[model samples]
Target: MKPGRPAAGSSHWLFTEDRLREEVTESQPALLPLDAWHRARGGRMVPFAGYEMPVQYEGIMAEHLWTRESAGLFDVSHMGQLVFSGDGADAELEKLLPGDVRALKAGRMRYSLLLNEAGGILDDLMITRLPEGHPFGEAGADDLYMVVNGAVKFDDIGTLREHVADRITINHMEDRALLALQGPKAVDALARLVPGVADLVFMRAGAFDWQGVPLWISRSGYTGEDGFEISLPGDAATVFTDALLEQPEVKPIGLGARDSLRLEAGLPLYGHDLDPEITPVTADLGFALSKRRREERGFAGADHILAERENGAVARRVGLIIDGRQPVREGADVLDGEGSMVGRVTSGGVAPSVGKPIAMAYVPVAMAAPGTAITVSQRGKVHHATVAAMPFVPHRYVRAGA
Candidate 1:
């Protein structure tokens, strides 16, 4: 299985066998078995990430505010989970990525990118080294667990198989479901359901048993809050979710609010801020390139990535704070102080937390720094804007000893 080009009309550059399904129709909605769980809780289902997921239990704005103030439950089962293992697994993975996967300690997780030979990001993902005692980590199989974007799962899996075919084994965890519980009070709310999880530090993951159901819990989330992403068998997903929601601090949130939250957190969305044409450096994700990896230059596109790191890239991704109540959306032109077109907005919305319109765009490196005055063209109007620091809302990740 060699990595091949994505199918026609596909959003990603690659595809997986399991991801090839007929188009979703109103008569045959793509509902997960857990649909009954959401329906029982009064959730409104909508298509998202290629799966029919709950958009809200109450409402977007209410759930959004509650998460910010407390905790919110989100069904992210649509995310693709795959296991890669065999001899030289790390080495093979390095050939396709720019991250330092070999250095990741067991029980730790890392955010990395799958890159094409040209250094363009195919998809961003989270990889974790399963602990020695884990089921996936038996002798003769050195395994790496991955969670990828649902929209690109098929393509992503194909790419992985092609790159490491015969050299490694790839297993898609289709039996599992992913759930994200996020917000300032996420730890406190989850503690009552799964004790000791609140103590896990950012980027750390481990297996735990909750009421006889096993779960892979990671102390991480996209909301820039103290939160967790739990992976468990599909059969137990609703059971675990319902238990968490029983806490008064937890509410159900939707994709609309999820988008706004990540925007405010300065996190990049794959198809929007990241794609096959965007390299990590130009995407302002150079931090994800480990220091050792930069020095070693063993990963794919390392030559170009290292060169850009040393000499600096021509274009840089940046955050923008727009004036007025009107929001500037993706594809909006970004202009310099003199009103010359400089770039384009990749993602934007009225930030629920910031109480104003915010956006992210890529501009000439010279104009990417904070305090740079700029203009955004939206609906034929030029709006006053400025280059702002990311995380329109400050991150509140809980540290190990915090």
Candidate 2:
């Protein structure tokens, strides 16, 4: 709702560098550990998630295409890396997260939602249990690791503290810097630097050491590519990044490409596609709800989410393919054939990889089927669109099926 800024939903959504910088500069946003490094590389800096970060380097389109074909390094240190410790960690986590923490094997992670009592998503996150006998700093092996959206990290921490028992300790790993290396050639570049990283399968994490500095790596990322997320001491970030860029395949990517890549992957970003008003079922993220947890119904918001799961939610998120050349921005109104506004778009743009304008929106369940006709109204212009399956471009995560 700020003037001249794109109403792209999330704070990390679409932004023009000048306007974004103007708005965030007055706030005195904190700089990333690699702040100087990004500037030295010609990264166009913008304010996002209370941090001065890069929105694009070479350019969004070129960077996006490069990441699809090769590998792109992204500085995502803004995301909060939390390590949960203490007695009954697994059981305590299950009380808030919809996923089956107890059933999760060591060194594995799963996408999960932090739900309130109403089943509405507070935040979407990934939870990983450390490998057996693998301890993270002062935390024991049984401690759990979580990566949460940076924009809502403080709120997420507050939610956990208020809900989980006193024995559980939430350590915010702010001193660490997180980096994501993504694309088909990611493994080729990463393996050369860290030999054993090639063994980590999708959704699995492990502990490693890089030049005397400890690293916690997970073979998972936001761009839906076969990649890895590395957590290491902030001081080592520059050196490690330098080494990775030395590879012929790796390049520093910015936020613009990151957003487009995730959109094309059919991944919903927190705060934009997801919020307190949207449940897992409504967001078309039922897979995050584990089979065992669904039967037990012990997690928060289980009652409403389960009922919606069984009977079907009134409105469900679906993919939309715009019929024209121009892209549809978020906040566009979704209209039925009769012209009544039925829903709205959450994330949308001209998908660079797909070469078509694609979007994710919420609409009546009856109109959610693929091939259904829909209308989008943006900036006083009406555009025709069709309901379609997501991932306008297919996901290429390594070991996705395995």
Candidate 3:
């Protein structure tokens, strides 16, 4: 499936099935900093998340397999890069997020969510605490770095400005570009440029410089592979990308392969697998809710979120393995035992890594256990599917000290 066809949340290009394409086509899409560079490399550019992004440079199947075996570089610059500074930034952010923001030590990255008053997810994001010496922040100032979905970044910024205390200054770093170098051989390719990055493990981030350009590098990615997400100035995007592509093991990957890779990894896409109607508990993302935050209960919709956690949500997000060779896309209706609709498939595709058609859906708790059989109706055709454990493909992250 084309990445543009799905509901894109920007930074993640969150997936949907059909409406996203229609939404992007209705407006003029902006160009990325690597726009001309992508075109020069034979990238098939498409309108996605209000920007012209490369869907593929080569075929999706080829890129998917290559990344699983070697290394793939993705232009994720369309995602929002936000910096929170001034006094009490961390504590102020904690009020809107369920994660224990105040306890996030410097140079560590945490996966978190921007939630609404009702515990509905506004957007999922990554937050990093930049230490005192990080070039992105003042020499002695610790700053909180956030990367939000590009599709809703402006809205996210507005929400932050409105919700957080005025003392916390939120700077939208629009001049920055983000890149992900993923796969088994990713570390090797990146270490050649910034040797210090080799020391960082999963969920950690640090600042480094290459030929005078400052980079905020993190040992993280969404593809269930050992990878790094690098943030740099937009002006340096073409040069840095070219440098990575020069490595023998690295290849330019498109959003199509990215969508498939994340699907196989069992990571939820914002607009599809997550939305305002879905809380972190129902989406099976309780990990983002820290223990301290749960007890303190200061975040938005804490009452509902905590209650749902204790009593269980009405619906659960579960993985599904569709029967047969034909794959189902998003918006497929999940059916109960008696043929009545019980839920809906949020994300579905042929998982290249798993070599099967896998999907994610919100189903009643009774239908969420693994091995439970469920029926699906797509385009009036009936298809059988079974609940399966997620990350259809095993993850290869380089854990701490590994």
Candidate 2: the clashing residue pairs are none
Q: If scored against the real structure, what TM-score would every candidate get? A: 0.90, 0.94, 0.94
Candidate 1: where are CA atoms >4 Å away? 1-29, 135-141, 337-340
lDDT tens readout by residue for model 2, 301-379: 9999999999999998889999978767777888887888888888777777788888888888999999998899887
**Candidate 2 at residue 73, lDDT?**
98
**Candidate 1 Cα RMSD (Å):** 5.9
Candidate 2's C-alpha lDDT? 0.86
Candidate 3 lDDT by residue in tens digits, 1-402: 111122223222223323335356455898889999999999888777889888888788889899999999999988999999888888889888999888889998899999999999999999988888876656436589999998888899999999889988888888888999999999999999888998999999998998899999999999999999999998998898899999999999988888889988999987777887789999999999999999889999899999999999988989999999767667778888788888888887777767778888889998899999989887788999999998799999988866
lDDT measured at residue 2 in model 1 versus the true structure, 0 to 100: 16
Best-performing candidate as measured by lDDT: 2
Residue-level lDDT of model 1, residues 1-402, one tens digit each, is: 011122223221111121223245456556675788888878777665567776666666677778889998888888898888787787788878777888877878899999987788999999988776664435343678889998789899999888875868888988888899999889898888888897799999887888888788899988888799998898888778778878988887866677778888999988778888788999989988988888878777888877887899888889998888777777778777677777888777677778888888888899899999888776578887889999799999877677
Clashing pairs in model 1, backbone N/Cα/C closer than 3 A: 1-162, 14-155, 15-154, 15-155, 16-154, 16-155
For every model shown, the clashing-pair count is 6, 0, 4
What C-alpha lDDT do the candidate models reach, one value each? Answer: 0.79, 0.86, 0.86
Error of 3 at 166 (Å): 0.8
The number of residue pairs in model 1 that clash at the backbone is: 6
Whichever of 1 and 3 has more TM-score, that candidate is 3
For all predictions, the C-alpha RMSD in Å is 5.9, 3.0, 3.7
Candidate 2 TM-score, C-alpha based: 0.94
